[model samples]
Target: MADTLTSILKKLLNQPTAPFHEYHVRAQIEQYLLDVPNVELSTDAFGNLLATYRKGKHKSTPVWALGAHMDHPAWVKVPGKTDEWEFLGGVPKNLVEKKENIALRKESGDMAPWGFPVVFEDGKVHAAACDDVVGCAIIVAVFKELSRLGLDATVHAAFTRAEEVGFLGAWHLGKHWPFGKDAVFLSLETSRPVNGAEMGDGPIVRVGDRLSVFDHELINVLMRTAAEQGIRVQRCLLDAGACEATALQACGIRSVGLSVPLGNYHNLDDDQNIVSEHVHIEDVKQMINLIVALVATKHDGLGERTLEERVNLRMKEYKKYLEIGNAKYEEMTA
Candidate 1:
């Protein structure tokens, strides 16, 4: 299983991708999942690929849509200029000022724009585009496993575009909201670590991003699922940047986030040199396991315990003390 998962991730991480130019990445994902049993794939009006897996008699309510973008920060060909290329997405300007041997083509005669090479070595994924390609690989693995097991549930995997520029695909999907308001959107990402979150610790049950906090109930659900399955996971706010969850949440859908800690983010090292981004192999594996566990767990009202219900439960122990104190105070006043 580890070998198979690694192969899938390697294939995806090797695909050339950039903001608004995710054709190669999308094609690779389609090849992985197009023929899986009990799964249906379709491209939305916004060009986001949506794959739905359905099986059995019982279905999990308020469906789970695992989402990840297919693009990373990379160079793209400028229009009408044979030799001019423009970089897209966010990479520090200081790092690219002296662009000398920074960009390398993967193969002879490969016509894709400038990007770093991809390699998986020493139990780490070194690539020009690990930011969300790792996230895409996770979704593919989860969907394939679920389809093979034929779980009595329905879930969707969304491969979005242009997340590096902005959450453009997600924003459009949310505005249209094909799955209605009952679904929960989970944005899977490979994010720069912050707030003590470290690589190799495990996948993060992300609490929030720089923009806004995620759905409270959905966050509780992820935490509860991780605990019950004993899957080690970190919980933190990756405030260095925002993810697609912010876009979906703003559009009035319940959205949350999950991520693996990333190093040399956007292919920029601590010394501001262009290099391949990397992530821990163990963290990637754990994230896959955690998401599968979450699907098997029951979701009906799992994390919907209201604040009122919680207060009432605690009040049982403290109500008598409050009553006695109130009576003594009234007697003294009289």
Candidate 2:
């Protein structure tokens, strides 16, 4: 499993990608999934890639729809100009202006854009596009592992584009609504660590982002699964930036988020150098492990509890205390 994780990460992270220019990343993902059994791939009208994996019987009523973007911050060539260019996506402005050395694509390619080279050493990964490419890689690994184990489950994954520029791909998909409304969406991200989320601790069960709160039931399910499987995971609100989950949730879909804590987010370090983004290798592995377990056990058969149900349970527990308090108040009043 670790080998597979490493292989996918290398392939995806090495691809040249930018907002609205995710051709190479999309192509790599296609090549990787070509022979995976029981999986079907398709693209939405807006050019987002979707993969569906269905096998055996499903234990949960709502199917799982996982999503990740395929773009990173890069300088895009301005149309009708040879030398002029404009930056897309979120990176520190000071670092962008510095114009550090970027790793160009191996062969002659479209627009000839470049980014930071992927370097994996000392149990850490530093890459140009770990922001969401790692997220994309995680989805690929999950699909492959689930097929190999032949788990009875249904999972859909979306490799969306242009996330770095305000969730463009995600917003479009939400408008079209490809997956059923009943399906729950999970946004996988390599996010800036905030609110005590730390790299190497484990993957984070994101409670919410800056934009919106996620489905409580889904968060509970993810946390429960991690505890049950003994996988270390953090729970927090990664408000460093908004993710694709916020867009889906805005469209009225039940959405939640998961992340691997990132360092030097968007290729900008504390000193403002334009270097590769960083993530702990073990955190990536644990993210994969937790997602696989969630699918394999069909969310550990913990049926989604309604708000009323949760409140009722608590209410029942405190009812005797409420009665006792009422009697004491009545005696006082009399």
Candidate 3:
């Protein structure tokens, strides 16, 4: 599985220009999904790959969707010579500068590296494609784990395309598909700095995003589950960026974003900014645990609690701590 993860990352990095060209990254994932049992796969008009693993003895149980965007920003080729393709400027400077054996396919569709140092060991180069590819890998990993454990509700995985280009894939899916109006939606994206989800820190329970706030009942369930399971998790909100969950929320679907802490996100000026070695297997394990809990609760029905309700519950807990501090102050005065 570790080697498979590496291979998926390498494959994505190799196709930096058009990450969603169907035959490129999509073909690779399609092949991988074939190995798992009880999986039904299909694609939408907008190229959103949907994989469903039905759980429960009956098919009428509520369905849950786990979304992850598979597309990354890349330089698209304009009409020109194969070797003379213009740098259309979507890649981060750090990736372009540090990329080994950097290649380009011009409007003619011919491929050739720009002739720098082509870094190919068994064959792989470091690049920015890992941004959401890591997310895709996590979704696949969770699916495999859930299948092994035998889940109870139908768990649907949607690998949407064109997330970098204004969340086009998610918009289409949420608008057209029947994703269950009340289904629990979780988007696996990259987390923020400092308070972000670290690679070894376990799965992040995102409280809110740039677009919309998560369902409070779902957040509380995840938080309580993590605490009880002794899993490391961080609560965070991205200030400058957005995820597929944002688009879903805009369409009135309850969603939350989960991310593994990433180092170099969109900033391309410095190679050091890129995540060096933070990706850890332990974090992935905890993520699997959270997914399992959610899948197991298919029959429990979506909780009636609201975001305000959960916030008040937290405030009550905080008040106790405040009272302790007040008592300490009074004793000191006496």
lDDT values of the candidates? 0.83, 0.84, 0.62
Best by lDDT, which number?
Answer: 2
What TM-score does candidate 3 get on C-alpha atoms?
0.71
Deviation in Å, model 1, residue 260 alpha carbon: 0.6
List of clashing residue pairs for candidate 1: none
Off by over 4 Å in 3: 1-22, 58-62, 79-127, 194-199, 267-278, 298-334
Best by TM-score: 1
lDDT of 3 by residue, 122-141 (tens): 32333445556667766776
Order of quality (lDDT): 2, 1, 3
TM-score of each: 0.93, 0.90, 0.71
Mind giving the per-residue lDDT tens digits that candidate 1 earns over 1-334?
A: 3338888988998888878888998999999988888889998898999988877755555578899999887766676676656667887655554547344533212224346666778889888789899999999999887876767777788899999888899998898877656578999999999998998899998899999999887887888788877888899999999999999999988999999999998877888777789999999998998888777666666654667788998899899999999999999999
- Residue 10 shift from truth in candidate 1, angstroms: 1.2
lDDT, residue 80, model 1: 68
